[model samples]
Target: MDFFARSLAIAGLSVSLAACAGAPAQSRPAAVAQTAAAPPPMAPPGPCALRPSCDTPFPAPSKREFRHNRSGLLASALGPRHRGRDLFLLPGTPQWVLGKFAYGPADKDLKDEDIDVYLLRGCGAAWEKVGTYRTTEDEGSHPAVVGVADEGGQIFVNLAQVLPGGPLGVGRHRIKMVVAGDGTSVDLFLEVLPAGARIVVTDIDGTLTEKEEALVGDVLTGNHSQTHPGAVDVMRSLSGRGFFMFYLTARPHWLEPRTREWLRLRGFPPGIVHTSVTATGRMGGAAASFKSGELSLLKTATGLLPELAFGNMPSDVDAYWSSGIPRTFYYKLADDARGGVKHDDYRTLLPSLGELPAVCP
Candidate 1:
């Protein structure tokens, strides 16, 4: 939970305007309909309303750091230096396809670097050129019509500008960024959700993995991760039922890429991943605050709180309670009478999977 907010930021990979609030995810034979509360009166279609996702109150710190440049073997070992910030938006809101760029083993931030951007519908192999953008020195995203990256390693390629005419469509799309210097690139995701979509949000370190320190132990010892037994099947099944899976964690910013990699490696359902860039989360005692704050942003953006949530910390309980999520489960805790259920076995919920609602259009 200590790493929750930064992870939400790193793990904060998403939002869905006009999403719905509903009961805890349960299995029943009936198809359920989400209880979508009406969204705030949207500003009439205009420049402001057309804006894509932006940095929340706590935006990422875009600080440039210099390091001994790395290439080839060493660079490959440290993994991809550039990572695009994945975004989720309701159709009306355009997306600022943002990314962080760096080079070498230490992820030395790159600036004034030229990049080629491309778009691939449905993540197919065929790619289409979008534009040529440059990494500038700005920390905040104010992407021009062309596309841009800030010195803080942040890139903002506005969807309204690239795919002009309308907001990006529903379903997943890929945004590719190729560094002009090395011809190397990274692919980030853009999940465009429809109004009143159903979503399931969860934390990673403990909620998904076997325990809070499990991930750290695995990373440090170079061992395979140990996920809670049914975590994978349960999440994948939820996705199959048309529920959007949100993997919100409190990991640090730099870990976002790895976090996504781990989820993919572990067979967790595909979804946006968010990690925090804040210095105060987790051990700093801001995990709950970060989560509630982020949840509040999501509530306003999507017009609904998550229908179901999972976690394993007091902070998680606190965050969910404040967000008013109806169904929240903690893997480790006993059932709390106030709220939240004591449940961890995902397989047990499989029989009644149909009870969960299909996402609303």
Candidate 2:
């Protein structure tokens, strides 16, 4: 399907704004919506005398490094069941960036960099300074090296923790990141999804996309990324119904942008997309370790277990089962030795949604 048509089919031109307390109006799909007043101005970040403070140290990165920079902002979709009178938990969210510097014929060790973070209230609203943070330089994956090596390395800049702050006004918030060495920047949105009793986790490769013989160069090159006919639609339908959808993939971090772009081009609903920093290739046991580790981290951060999980490979079966989600609700797109009821494809299984209860009993 063409990009525009797929978008229309999955997310019709009309938007339905479901009420989510403190969630920004823009975060919802669309419908008649009310806007909440902006929160009172918070104090800006402290000024730094040095050109590169903890937040923005690397102010003049080379062009080669800038082109390959990557930044990510994420917030836990799950929040506390009850807010106590004494403790206020800032939503568990993080702002981070990954990039290289001073490109040359051969990669060299990188010095630590700095980044600045600002929180956006809304469109045209003044952005408030959150804080300045520093990156930890490390060697990233390279063709010449099996493990982390100094050559052709990348650096990681993370906020470390969500710094203490005043209560934020109810609404979606945007995080803006600026590279200190160069004037490069990226922005990401954070919103606390409405409370839902059930969460759904799905695998990307063989389950949503066409069952591939292998998922190496084909995926990285955008050559083998056709989605199943109804997979995108079903995921959208679930998201609209308030299910907290999370896309769990073992695709290496470098492939993240491409994977997300592919999903958007195919009209899949937006959700939290998790990936690994390294690859053991498709269906490797290390992938099971990565997936399960991610699931464990998700549970620890969000305090919610996914009620439903989906996958197509044996690694997926082991990962989901080990994460404490039931094998019954764990639907498989194809058969494996692990043994779960398998669906021929999403088209046949989507109808079963009507039979399932909305809230976990």
Candidate 3:
């Protein structure tokens, strides 16, 4: 059988074993009891009698309130000193305004002369310039203001206030900030999230493995393709702490079973596995657009919003950034070859295996 088919078979076996292990035990009956006989069957009711009138009132809307903190942590081990905020928006709500852009010290060193924020929705071909604000100096504590300005420091237009509108929908939204100074610009995107959902999506290849190249040579054929140190323990701890975990990859669907089995063997829990459509081609890194689309679809199917994401590639960052989810924990192999110990964002790194925190509020 091909790799995918074999993997499916293995998954089936594992599922069967899991089912058996979960079967409920039977209870013993009481000793010696006298029983009575049953009565004969009666005639069926007439059609008119069977069709009894019943008025079912519409159920009242649920009153339970959904509450969650709107704050989140931003950690980057890459040393650039990342800073950002987490805004909580209602699912399906229309894009809300982020108010105004305040130029910071970083803006002073810009090669470009102006800064702009763009709204990228639905990972498609176009992005809308919803609002644009500029700063007088590259560095300052200027008061907040709205509207667009020209290169000569003249106000061109006043943009509308950032307001929220849209039906109840949920998922991540990415906001890209472009700072143009001198003759260059840098694009920094941050994710926004809805409340209550706490899912974690991770890529499986280089981010979690030392094999920096081809999957066939590094993972499929080599015995060295094992889980990174501390990976399994962290995953187990997260699972125990009530965080839903999933593996999202551009890997072919045919590899699902083997990949699932590999993860199971490596101590990762059984969570949803997303693979690309066969027509999309083979095991390759998905485009940021493609991953963004998948993230939307997954959000709909699972009814859970991911609060944090983890991965190592630029594309992964792009995808997560666009989805609008808050909190991203990125990692790279330590430069000194001290294994995976050294990391860029160690503040939010998983606690050591035995030191995992309790899940209680």
Candidate 4:
């Protein structure tokens, strides 16, 4: 079987992709190809370019948010119908917005679909409609991406290549990846971490939840997701002390929205959030591989590493240890078999945690 087919089988997407609690997403296809505007410079690959040092020409301000110009697609011409937010990163992270395209009831790849990316910076009264370009570079046929999307329906774009300026300014910047044919688009948020930021990494799911994360969906008892009694307070204390939060999860990418909502509903501090991109990335031992690799990528491009790490599973142990996180903590594991300092409650450790020197300047 091909890579995507194999991934689907491993993920069991054919039976469960629809059951996932969000907009219907086509099963991820194989890695899409990418290209930039000019000659490839000394830049990290699409997924790892975190140095915010390039740009495409900025588009003008727009009074209106993006919307599909027309909808009814499947006809003599099968066309793209949906878009999805792709990757997130620190500023200067040049990567394509993640997207997929399909047509018809079977959801076949809408090949040769040209995708355009537009940056929307909230202007005083209007959004500065940054230039809509093909690659993160400039407007042109992304020969490789178009070729891949033609075969696979991933309407992806590489990040800020030889755009035209310095990195995107830090803060919340909105980006839209649109089907050039129709206005069908995926709205995404791009955030740049504070320069020279110190990071604290924490796992979600079993680590933070007072009970199984599934309980957050308990419509019967109305039991919203609950964190450990002191979880929020402790995290807030750390945030107050100047460390940035980095939420890592092995959950499938489809759950990212629910994950974000849970974080906000529970009053967690704002920070970078990363969800596993594949089912294999999260299950069993791959969780550690995924998390460790992701942290390594962040450090490679951004030069920032976690000063403290928290996890609740053996996978987390492997992840933290392999990533070289100096200070680590895990929930219920006994003995030193799992590694890291054991902790029973966040409150009990508050004093010592607070005593640690502040991370932010």
Candidates in order, TM-scores: namely 0.71, 0.58, 0.39, 0.63
Q: Report the lDDT tens digits of candidate 2 across residue range 1-361.
A: 1121123222221221122333442233221111222222322211211011112222332322222233211111111110000000124443333333221111122235455666554222455666655544544432321112333333333332453554343333445555554434443444343344356788887677775432343432224356777777566556545555677777644344445445555656555556554422234577788778777766664577777787767777888878878642333434453545576557776676634544421
Clashes of each: 26, 18, 20, 15
Residue 355 error for model 4, in Å?
Answer: 2.6
Count of backbone collisions in candidate 3: 20
Across 136-172, the per-residue lDDT of candidate 1 in tens digits comes to 5556545432122244655666776676435567767
In model 3, which runs have C-alpha deviations exceeding 4 angstroms? Answer: 1-197, 218-224, 279-285, 333-348, 352-361
So what's the TM-score on candidate 2? 0.58
Worst 10 residues of 1 by lDDT: 25-34
lDDT of 4 by residue, 1-361 (tens): 0122224343334323332333222322211111222322322212211222223343432333223322223312332334344333566566455555544324444454456666654212233334443322222334443112222555454546634544565554556665555444444555556676677899876678775344324211223457887777667667767676788887654344445556656767655567765423255477778788878877776677898888777778888888888889877655362458887786776777867665452
Off by over 4 Å in 2: 1-110, 120-129, 138-176, 183-197, 213-224, 279-282, 327-339, 355-361
Identify the superior model by lDDT, candidate 1 or candidate 3: 1
Residue 128 Cα positional deviation in candidate 2, in Å, after optimal superposition: 4.9
Candidate 2 vs 4: which has more lDDT? 4
- In candidate 1, stretches whose alpha carbon ends up further than 4 angstroms from where it belongs are 2-80, 103-107, 138-151, 164-166, 279-281, 334-337, 352-354, 359-361
Minimum summed lDDT over a 10-residue window in model 4 is located at: 28-37
Clashes (candidate 4): 15
Residue 195 accuracy (lDDT) in model 1: 63
